[model samples]
Target: MSTATAASKTWIRTSASIRAYLQLMRPANIVTAWADILAGYSATGLVMSEQTWPPLLWLLLATTGLYAGGVVFNDVFDAELDAVERPERPIPSGQSSLKGAIGLGIALLGLGIGAAAQVSELSLGLAIVIAIAALLYDRFSKHHSLIGPINMGLCRGCNLLLGVSAVAEQTQMLWFLALIPLAYIGAITAISQGEVAGGQQRTGVIALLLLSMVTGALFGLSFLPSVQGWNLLPFTLLLIGLVFPPFLQAADTPNADMIRAAVKAGILALIVLDASLAAGFAGWPYGLVVLSLLPGSKGISRLFAMT
Candidate 1:
């Protein structure tokens, strides 16, 4: 072969490898982590000013690392299962090596915790707990239908708190608000368990109920003395517009493709849900910033499956 041909071949191989790693990380799903950071800021009633950027950047780094690391670790642990049920996945498809995936996961986990530590001791501690919860879910909890959802939900809730911990005051409301994501994500994860084949209608109903709790909580938050003046109606309506339809459709038809679509809708609409929370506690402007991620994530989703 000519030198140019060899060089082109090498470039193609390198590009393919990079794509595999990105797939392992599931960047579209990872974008949802930004919800945690903004919600954390909202919980604190902190305005989005220039000074906020420094700490916000740290939280973003921490959340991105942890969320990406968790997805990578899950892929690593599920490699054998994927080989059987999902042979096209990066690890099983030979595009990404198992050893490489594991190494990247471990590195990202450490980088996440270390980055949070740069922000504050509380953030670091929360990051460590989040990492452990994620690891356990990947190793053990995933097989147990009930525990798996709870574990995943808690991880997301911790992601929110990881951002809250950056604040000095750490209000009780922030802690209380964390439960919304916990309930919502837990329910979503439960429903996702059946996406590959089919899920029970009961499970789908329960997931819808869980989502109700989160939305209801957001509605109630509008009544709070701190957030009384700003109208949260638009935010709530937008969330319902984005999230409610697919889940309702999934509840009626619990087939493999339908459930998977439901799962993907839930994951994608998470930005809208998070934006509602941000708007409820903070203001509409910050919520708009969170909302922007939804369309941006569509680009990521095209590159790889969010599920």
Candidate 2:
């Protein structure tokens, strides 16, 4: 081949490979991790100002690395299953190697903890704990019906705390708030198991409603005074609109395609959850910034898998 032609082919190959790795990290899901960190800031009443920059920046690094690593490792562990169920995935399709995924995951996890260590001992400690939970969930507990979703939820809950605790001690209120995402994601995870084949998911629908009700209860009580002038009713409505619409759309049939739709929606809806929390607890501007990620995440999802 001509030199230019050869270089062109090489560039194409490299671009394709990079896209595959990006799919592995699942950028849409990563936005949810960003929400977790933002919620942490909101929990501690840290506004989106210069004063909050240091810890917020570090926690962002730590959570992203840790969350990305956990996801990468999940693919590593699920390679065989994906081969059968999702053969188009990067690993089984040969777009990326198992070894490369492993290396990347470890690097990200290490980067995450190291970033946390830059913040404070408590942050480092929480980062380690979440890392352990991620490892356990991916390696051993994922197949367990009860343990899997709970384990995943714990990772998210700690992620929120990882942000809050990075700069200051977590209050009892923050602890309570963390459980909202935990319950939401855990319920969604429980529903996702049937995505491969799909079927009636009445229980999943009910679970979603119950979780929403719980979150609504918290909003109703006005347990926070961090953000002002954001109406509770409208915020609650927006939260429901952003979060439950996809799941509700899929509820009628719960078939494979619909279930996949719900699963993907649930994954992206994490940003809405985060935005809702930030709006109610931090400020509407913070919530708006978090919500703005939705478009970018959607744009990326078109190029790669979100779930």
lDDT of each: 0.83, 0.78
* Candidate 1 regions with alpha-carbon error over 4 angstroms: 171-173, 228-230
Model 2 Cα lDDT, one tens digit per residue, 238-303: 667665766776676777787778777777777777777777766677778878887887887887
**Against the true structure, whose TM-score is highest?**
1
What's the true lDDT of residue 227 in model 2? 43
Total clashing pairs in model 1: 0
What are the per-residue Cα lDDT tens digits for candidate 1 across 27-75?
Answer: 9987889877877777664455556777778888988889889989998
User: CA RMSD for every model?
Assistant: 1.5, 2.1
Q: Which regions in candidate 2 have their CA more than 4 angstroms from the true location? A: 48-50, 171-173, 199-203, 224-232
Q: Which ten residues in a row have the lowest lDDT in candidate 2?
A: 224-233
**What is the RMSD of candidate 1?**
1.5
List pairs with backbone clashes in candidate 2. none
